[model samples]
Target: MNENENISVLFKIVVVLIIVGAIFGTFMSIVNFALIRSISNEISTLNNLTISSMNDRMNRMDSDISSLESNIQPGGIVDEYINAYNFLSNTNLDLEKLLTFASETPDATYLTVYIAGRSNVWITVTNNGQSLLQADLKPGLSDYVFFISGNPNVKTSYTIMLAPSSIITTSDASATYILLAQNGKTSILHTKSPSLSVSNILK
Candidate 1:
């Protein structure tokens, strides 16, 4: 062939080789990028699954711990404490019922009086103008016993007088009276009784 034609053919071959190299490099880059993205997605999915499994395990562990705590035996401290409290409460109720029964019986020889006050006071109990008991009472609650002279089954009248210890005059003192029977019936004598004068009748 001629020298110029040979040079032209060599130039065309070089150009074609360059174009093929460029296309191959671009395709390889695209393939590498797709592989990297797919690998990253798989890694993220694996991490999510691991986290979910760990959370499920933790939840199960918590539930097991709660169940163990709830399975306390009857001889445990918590159970014993509850049992003792119930026993004490029941015993107190039984004692109260017994006292009430005794107080309502016809053979009972004494009457009980409960006093509640806001301040210190002097109390006097009288039956038919005869003084039965005289004492000093402090604030809060107090119980007193007075013997009955007559037949307990019959109706009886009694008087209670309360005077503040800080006061000297009897005019400011308050008085309450009642008629009670052994059958556990009572009637208040005064209309303007003190608010703290609460009584329970036994049956």
Candidate 2:
């Protein structure tokens, strides 16, 4: 009878040890799951913050590009710069033309005349018996003619002649005035015939 009682006690102790091991395994599993979940949450939050920072940087870059485009639009700094460059180029061209004309006559006693016409015409300037100048004058085009008499004290006479260009037909000959300037005096001479004369213009 005693032997049977001891066998029963040993069986009961084994059952209790098995139950405790199962409970400890369950508790360890819960702890491990909680740790894993907390780590995953932290990583997700970091990714979101990184994405937000990148979006802010991209937004700032886009704003800067838009502002730059507006600044380069019409009537802006870029437009004004182009206008100034063109103006300076034209001014330089005009100055070069004036310098070329001034080099032709250096003496103070020489008579200088500028001839301009509204229509295409052929021009000639003569003093005494010598030919002084000849050129073709067109609309917006002019020529500087210079002549010097042997004696500056004596007044000089110049015979000016104007004729239609070869491109002009008789029917196409319209009324136009040729401008002549000398010694601060400007004469608007009418083109009526092929020949004209001016005697009173003096240096």
Task: Give the C-alpha lDDT of model 1.
Answer: 0.47
Worst 10-residue lDDT window, candidate 1: 163-172
List candidate 2 stretches off by more than 4 Å. Answer: 1-17, 82-91, 97-203
Return the clash pairs for model 1, or none.
Answer: none
In candidate 2, what are the lDDT values of residues 39-120, reduced to their tens digit?
Answer: 9999999999999999999999999888878768755566556544543444354555445444432342233332222345
Per-prediction TM-score to the true structure, in the order listed: 0.36, 0.37
Quote model 1's TM-score.
Answer: 0.36
**How many pairs of residues collide in each model?**
0, 0
lDDT of 1 by residue, 1-203 (tens): 99999999999999999999999999999999999999999999999999999999999999988766765553455644654454344435445633543555455334443222234556655334455556665432234433343343334453223221111111113322222334454332221333222232121
Leading candidate by TM-score: 2
TM-score of the candidate numbered 2?
0.37
Q: What is the model-wide C-alpha lDDT for candidate 2?
A: 0.48
